[model samples]
Target: MHITMHDIYKSFGTNRVLTGVNFDLQEGEIHALMGENGAGKSTLMNILIGLHQRDQGTIMIDDKETYFESPKEAEQRGIAFIHQELNVWSDMTVLDNLFIGKERTSNFGLLNMKEMKALATEQFRKLSVSIPLNQEAGKCSVGEKQMIEIAKALMTDAKVIVMDEPTAALTEREIRKLFEVIASLKKDGVSIVYISHRMEEIFEICDRITVMRDGKTVDTKAIPETNFDDVVKKMVGREITDRYPERTSNLGEIVLEVKNTSKKGQFKDVSFSLRAGEILGFSGLMGSGRTEIMRTVFGIDSLDKGEIWVHGKKVSIRNPEDAVKAGIGFVTEDRKDEGLVLDFSIRDNMVLTNLHSFAPKGLIKDKKEQEFVDVLIKRLQIKTQSSATLVRSLSGGNQQKVVIAKWIGIGLSVLILDEPTRGVDVGAKREIYQLMNELTERGVAIIMVSSELPEVLGMSDRILVVHEGHISGELSKQEATQENIMTLATGGQ
Candidate 1:
């Protein structure tokens, strides 16, 4: 075995995050560590990388016991971690970000800029990424940034690399490219610990699968010996009879319409219509303008020139308040930065958007507020100790549920979700799917923007692919395939 973790336990205060978790990684093999959000996948990975100390555990690397006091120690021992969130600097160039911490000094004590750039260039070549070395990393697309992150880890001469949702932000084409890179890495005998909610990718790439649930390891099986359904059943502890809720042909008249929506440098000629009881999916490459289209529609960013119609009447949306007033709900891609108020409790955040409805005689109704929050908590299956628990104290999936519940409480005719299940676990993702079906059943229109091809394919009745600020293609549920979507997304004519 390349790495072995036994009897791992970690806790935050009185709450246990990881419980007696055990896992092993073998050389020249791809091992998938599967779990839902708050299931201790991140905690266990952090322990391996030394971000958090385990309460009890024994870590063995290459058949020898090892203790990592810091991430640098883990790095020196040929271990590298690629986080879900990119850790590169936005202000620095790609070459600089890769070589910033450890610079090779010449005999005269000068930084070796030429050698560093050459090495960074070589690494990018190996990954089939063509990012400019001198360009600021922030200007690159999310997929480019991801490739850069992985390249940095590889540059460390890592024997084992733990990737957390590496393809969450990538498009179908980029995902295929990533799989190729992973295959090459496996051929070179690099052990990979892959964590993802995507079971299809797990079956496609991983050699062995380890299932984690409620902070404990349930089973580890070879990929060929197990299937996606079996792995999901193990991760969720129940069989999912339906991947998506039943859709009825009960769509009402057009609720929201965009006429030739153009955001100049962001998106162009984006025309789409949403009606009650329909889920429309927007999909494309990282910079394909899916999120940008949502932002423009939500009035977070001004449209260069376009006409918006709500309920068959032309309306000018100058700000988010206008969009909200028009009965449009938007859950942004960056939830932490744009969606949640981390310091507030669930009740406070729940009523933030619709406080006027619950306030009586200009007085906030605490009891009524609690009632509303409680209803949402239960409706969305949001796991929490209490409705009064601070939003930040919850896991990523629970936090997302809170965000969705907040909007569902306010009442919306058109809902826009950008990467709604990006970091969410399988169980929570299924719950969200069920909630979407329930909402559609009640005649609510949904516009979902996602980077996961399988998710978009599985959940959407219609899919729109964007490429370089324009709509490249639109595919129906029957026509949508990984091959066709990737063809259009990567500039195929």
Candidate 2:
């Protein structure tokens, strides 16, 4: 299928999201969509797949003008969208999720369980996924859920597939398998609209690229004719020379320390120390217990046996309230589920953790709350019309900044950031890293858990590798390298 969108225009209330943008995709080719958050990349694709109605545009599929009334309508026409926010029904089994709307029947008005399992199994095998179809979808890790979504899309035999941040939660090995699958699909005459912030993956797989900025088409070029610097400049409308800023922070006395921490069915014998004015990075493969370890430290999960000390004094933390009282803030990996309240306004989400400051008289101060929110919106450069804007409407990058903003001015001494830059654009990522450096300079300790090896190596003053629920190795700033970190994460000698 060859898809072309020309002179597109879309708006939400007073916000003009897309204005006269143009894009095209060739059959059997991978096309990359590049833009900073809120630059209207997702909105354009959503318009194509019938998730949103375009105010004005011309959509031509196979040289015939077509506009789908709904996503199901689009899918029936062989176009499938695998969204960034997962749609797994937590209580349902994996097999059920794979065939939720398009279930196979046994001709007796009942589900054909055997046939469904066989089909799901074959799809998993194609993606090299090892998840059990009988297990509850909620029990799967983020990476496994990502693979499930991919497999579900493939089952449709889609002629055109839109993948949004498909590899954000996947490890290197899983990414390799997914890439191999993409190559096979391409040879079968499948057209893919790949949307990802990973520059390396885009350059490696995509045949052409279209970059957008401020709701307008900046430029389009063939992959062979463009370079990374050129694409970034087009995406952000400026030059970004340094991907990772230089670090100049000095470590101080230990502020948060965990000794022999153990959680049944998760990590065991985890020992670490985070000091003031330092960044400690956690590197590991999928399901390696890095997230679980941090969850326990933040009191979201129980620690079976361990000692958590704050400022050289042992403390008991049974829930998130206690962790907050102890001056620890956590930005969960699954931000949508755990970090912010999506339905609430940006001001409400920002002040959720800092209520103590706004409620000194046993009554919330609206003036104080608005003042604090305004400062953070400016400091973080969060693009929004007003603090009254719902967090759900903000871009992923701005939502992340709101998560980070919640911890600020809360008298926080230690901050735990998990997959901080998972789906943020390159420009927003640089802003986030700059924020981290500024926090450390202000004597706040940061513990970053990342799957991106370059981020771990570039931003960390010290690094720890996890393998099979254990601390496989630890390295200092001078000793860490991508090769050795992978070696330790894979349990090498």
Candidate 3:
């Protein structure tokens, strides 16, 4: 089925989003919607799925003007939305979550468990997914949970599927599987509206691309007719002259060291060192214990056997507070749940890490807090109306800035970042890279764990490859290559 959205206009109170935006999808074709954070991509899709009402617009499905008052109505019309954040219940079994709210029932109104299980199994087989039907949703890995979400879409017999950042949390292998599923869906004549920030994936999987910027449609073109640089320019409305800034910081003595770190099944025999004014990168496939190592060092997880030394002093960090007191800051990979409190105001989150500084006299000095927040907001270029704005209201890029600002407020000698630019746009990424450069110039060491190979090679002075909970190999900036990194990451000689 062909779908068209014309002159879509939506607003929340005085904040206007999606001003006169247009989007279209062809039957059985994979169309990508590309944009920077807060560029109305989500708003436009929410309108299409009936999550929010468009102030002014027209939605044409199969050339028929249609209005849906709720998501259920849209679903009944064969439109399925696969959210970026999986919507499965953690406590429920995969089988139960698959047929939620639309279960088949007998004449007596009892759920047909046998039929539902069979259908769920068949859907998994169709997608080549290996998740067990009886396993609890929460117990499954992130990639497996994502597969289950796709199976849920199939259970609805959806004709048009809207996928939002489907591979954001997936590893290389899982991403390949997802692409295979998308190809299969296209072969079955199912249209897909894929939204993602990963440019390589778009070039590989999408037939067409639509770009949006600042609440307006920028341009749409066939994949073969355009390139990555051109699309980035359209998305940000400017030429990004440099993706990575020049490294000017001089390497100094070691600032932090982890020796023989072992965390049972999580990771084992991990060892690394960070020098002053150096950006040390940790690269590996997902679930290779990269994140676990960072968490253990930051005191979020206990170390079974290891030693942490800061500035040549052996420090025992039993918790985050201890880590912070040791002059270390960590920006977690899952920013929404761990880095910032979405319900809190920007000012509150900005000062969360260093609240003691603001309340030294046992009472928060509001004027002093405001001054600090304003300076950081300007420095970080976080887009928001005021410090009073809730963190949840900000876009993904701005929210990440808030998290970074929080850590920056607390004076630090070392910083740990995991997937720092996971869901942000290209422009924001450049800004972050510039910030990292500035920090290192000030003699602050940083340890970054990234899945993007180019990012690791571009920004890191030294790279450490982790495989199956161990430090597989180490390479200098001049020696590191994608092939070598992958070889080490996959347990090579």
What candidate 2 gets wrong by more than 4 Å, as runs, is none
RMSD of each: 2.4, 1.0, 2.2
User: TM-score for every candidate vs. truth?
Assistant: 0.92, 0.99, 0.93
Best by lDDT: 2
lDDT winner, 1 or 3:
3
Task: Please provide, for model 2 over 101-180, each residue's C-alpha lDDT reduced to its tens digit, 9 standing for 90 to 100.
Answer: 99999879899988999999988988888898999998888788888899999999999999999999999888989999
lDDT of 1 at 219: 97
Q: Per-residue lDDT for 137-206 in model 1, tens only?
A: 8777666788889889989988889999898777666688788988988998999999998878888899
RMSD of 2: 1.0
lDDT of 3 by residue, 259-338 (tens): 99899988988888899999999998877899889988999989999899999999999999999999999998777667
- Please report the candidate that would top TM-score against the real structure: 2
In model 3, what lDDT does residue 212 have? 95
Model 3 pairs whose backbones collide: none
Residue 128 displacement in candidate 2 (angstroms): 2.0
Lowest-sum lDDT 10-residue window in model 3 = 138-147
